[model samples]
Target: MTAPTTMPKFSKENSERRRIAKQARRLSLRVLIVCGAAETEKQYLEGVKGLYRNPAVAVKIKTRDKSPLEVVRYAAAFSKSDKDDFDEVWAVFDVDEFDIAEAVREAAKSNVNVAVSNPCFEFWLLLHFVNRRGHLNSYKQANALLCKHLRDYDKAQLDFANFQDKIDIACARAKDIDETREKPYANPSSGMWRVIGQISPGSHA
Candidate 1:
């Protein structure tokens, strides 16, 4: 007969201390990004990483199925897992039909962050090309606009390389939209820039 072993409890204090130490060593700031879909967000972050290529930052992206809530739940769980030690965890989701309040609440409780887009993430990408002034009600609508610029764009392809030069513009535009719009109804809005800024600290693009 074999006896079962108990898992060690995670200590936030210790985690914080280790994170600080890691930072001091000039090591990469470990970030875990959980996305709702398989490609778009993943490719975009990957491009961000490639663009910066900074020794001080590292981004790891994982994808989930359809639910934004489920992605948040996964982020919460991943943050506490013993196998990984991350400085921050973010859930990338879109505000479509799903009510994101619960996911946001749960993420707050678990110390997980969320980068959400209204309509869809493509709208966030579109911000790099166009300063959209109106509401985008669906992902398809956003995609159509984006397609005009990226004629061959497909959801499976990240194509962030094409927009790398315009990141600052996208950031500024996203900021403007966020500032001008109303809460929970801010169409064509995204909180992605906040996370992107953190991931690429000091690098404006």
Candidate 2:
């Protein structure tokens, strides 16, 4: 009869190191953000990631110049295909002339989070400076309002530095609007604060 093979034993120090490594991996969170715009949203989110610089949180952004519904679908598919890779998946888009009902429904079905800025994303940026309750008719109108605060505001480029310190204030303002409004995605409202809260949990606003 063959002698029984003895199992190699791990030292206590080695076992402790293994346990710590597993714990660290468990603590880390990986996030994927799918944007409907090609530039501005990506720029702003990259800035948020840079500001936090949280070692345990990893953020990845993908841009698709598609409709909000399509963007949400893509994010959902990607999440499904690589479910193990990301702890959470988010879809960010504007309600600019597009019927966002389907997109919102899809996000809910796929368990994807959303950051929607009604009329335009600039409306969210505008909140960082001022809390205006007026309805925004179009992207141009929101951009114009944002320009009042960020004189050099441009859709092609974004300066995260301008909005960095004002994050808390912006979140508070957004929450106030959300609380008072009957519709969640009402004009001049933004769900961006929700995303910010997740990426930067320390945000009090």
Candidate 3:
């Protein structure tokens, strides 16, 4: 037999330096979505990556139907690279009637603040609407009152199920996007990043 091939060893200091470099590039308030399937997560991952950089994600189970703790622990470990690298942690998973909220609360209690996007499947699509054009915080209850807005604007046929699409349609129609109304600079007053908090009621962890 040929000589056994050994794994390349990395010095601890070198590994730590590389990790610090990566942490510097990552954003604060890192989000982790525990989507149900690989294919489904991949679809939403692509959409999220289109907007946010390197937003992490995971699956609903800990491992092969095991407890959720396994995965939560993994996520927690991955996030603690430098301890101060991120400000908040988001554990997003579909409401599976399995006390997911409690699980998330426990998982996040030790390290940082945590939030969850209930009905996680749609959380992916929700981001497409709420966070892309604007942060969700600027428009609270918009999802609930979307039909009313449409009616008020003489577009009564529209519905909340299609609310995000309609908003995007409106954005496209406005062509010149009134910076005064829908700014994209992360400044709620100027850009389209104002939809962070107001639009998503389905996300609570």
Candidate 4:
């Protein structure tokens, strides 16, 4: 008769730790962005998501016609509503006519992030072509500049092929401006890159 087989030592704690790490590697990032359903914002974000084609990242865009504070509240509420809700929720809006301070404060309480563009989001798009240094008085002025570079520019069309190659440059320019400015959300400023950075390759978030 063969001698009784000896059992190998196995650490339950080590097994559990390995399981958690494996799950983390498989877990995908889901982001919900509430941006008043603006076509321009939706198209641009979708373009970025499409370009990456990463199976580990998912991006959903939601639109609301409410005030900035309301948008922030909605995003926060949605994020807390379910166990399978988005991993990150963002409120994207322009600081044109609304007092965004209250929204920013509320977002902090609700654990929601904000990606605000001063003047408008067009400035962020314009950065793809040129590194602008001054304030764009209005969205119109920003759009005009973008048109000069992007022929037949229209928000309805999600064609960002022209800007895709230069996205890295745009991100760098935006970061430079953000660092030099006191109020990062002021005119000629945009925090969109923060959201974009999360979905970029090699991002653990």
Candidate 5:
């Protein structure tokens, strides 16, 4: 007589995990972020994505060392070309010396979102530690203020862990400053919270 074969037992935990992951993928929101700076903005965004680890949100970052207006235009073009790939497209840039009024208008017309940090993106990083309302004269000023909070702050290399736990506080501060602003590109303001909210809704809430 042939020996009876034993069937392997299936684990419920593994099956449940697979089901949840599949559901998350089905409900995922694909987002594309176009950055003006080549490093800082990209690195910060990547950090935000990593911190959230939200399977329901997919983020893609593209770096371009260009003016605010040019960045917006490029984002608009990409959004149009890859309409099916990205559910949302955002242009991240600094309100440096660029004429941002036209870029903002263009973004609106092209259905592209904008995250403009006045002086520089470092202003956004600074908000994670304190609510600074003073006007920043330039990127260097913002960078210096951020360094006060993060003693070893570096533009080329960012440490997201430093700001991870303070994300909610940063969003609140940024929102407060934005609400009081008469212009979207007002100094010492950061629109970054808008996009961050979408990536991790719980953080902004």
Candidate 6:
């Protein structure tokens, strides 16, 4: 055998390629988050799931309707052998100013990593987030005035019948009670999160 040959440091190109590959590997995985809602609100869950489907993704799904609270209380993986469990935990929640309401104040104070969509976060899920690329105005009158914005066309074909016209008929009919509670936390890409609303296993969001 010949004497051992010395090797040079990694070429810049090779190092750069490795860096890019590492970044790609890091970003490849995703996670799932569950929200609470009414029985009729299962559509929200399905809608989110349909839009997001990646093999490397994890899920923090919270079932709503019949067992919304129960799911929150017991959706985590548990250990049953030798009083030991090294399983993964994947889910998170958030707290809002009003979430500090007298009823849930003590719980909120704990600063527990609550799901972002607690209290009225569910309403945003129903109205807007259901469609990734859609907008839902709060006021009925605004909906009517902004008819030009809706492409569905005609009062009969729209999501809500007589949408704005009906709102004009009743006071506060178009009031968005949760509008005040609809604060959006920063997404992972945005780098502006002092929040815990979006739950992802091994994720920074």
Q: Cα RMSD for candidate 6?
A: 13.4
The candidate with the higher TM-score, 3 or 5, is 5
Candidate 3, residue 30: the lDDT equals 39
Residue pairs with backbone overlap in model 2:
none
Runs off by more than 4 Å, candidate 4 = 1-26
lDDT of 1 by residue, 51-141 (tens): 8776666677888866888999898787778355788899999988788888888888888888899889998899999998687778889
Ranking 2 against 3 by TM-score, winner: 2
CA error at residue 52 for candidate 4, angstroms: 0.7
Alpha-carbon runs more than 4 Å astray in model 1: 1-27, 201-205
How far is each candidate from the true structure, as Cα RMSD in Å? 8.2, 4.5, 12.9, 7.2, 5.6, 13.4
Candidate 6: which stretches are off by over 4 Å? 1-34, 38-42, 60-71, 76-112, 116-122, 125-205
Candidates' TM-scores? 0.82, 0.85, 0.36, 0.82, 0.83, 0.31
Error of 6 at 48 (Å): 1.9
Best candidate (score: TM-score): 2
lDDT of 6 by residue, 56-105 (tens): 44333444332333333433322112122212322233222233233223
* Decreasing lDDT order of the candidates: 2, 5, 1, 4, 3, 6
Instruction: Indicate the TM-score of model 4.
Output: 0.82
Model 5 global lDDT (CA atoms, 0 to 1): 0.87
Q: After superposition, how far is residue 78 of candidate 2 from its true place, in Å?
A: 1.3
| Candidate 2 Cα misplacement greater than 4 A, ranges | 1-23, 201-205
Candidate 2 lDDT, 111-162, residue by residue in tens: 8998999988998899899988898889888888888888888778888889
Q: Give each model's whole-structure lDDT.
A: 0.83, 0.87, 0.37, 0.83, 0.87, 0.32
TM-score of 1: 0.82
lDDT per residue for candidate 5 within 92-179, as digits (tens), equals: 9998888799989999998899999998899899998888999889988888888888999888888888988999999999999999
Candidate 3 per-residue C-alpha lDDT over 1-205 given as tens digits, one digit per residue, 9 for 90 to 100: 8999999998999999999877754622334333233443334333333433323321121111223454455556656753444444333333333455455666657552322233233322333344433433322333333324333322222123444344443333222333445322221211112222212223222
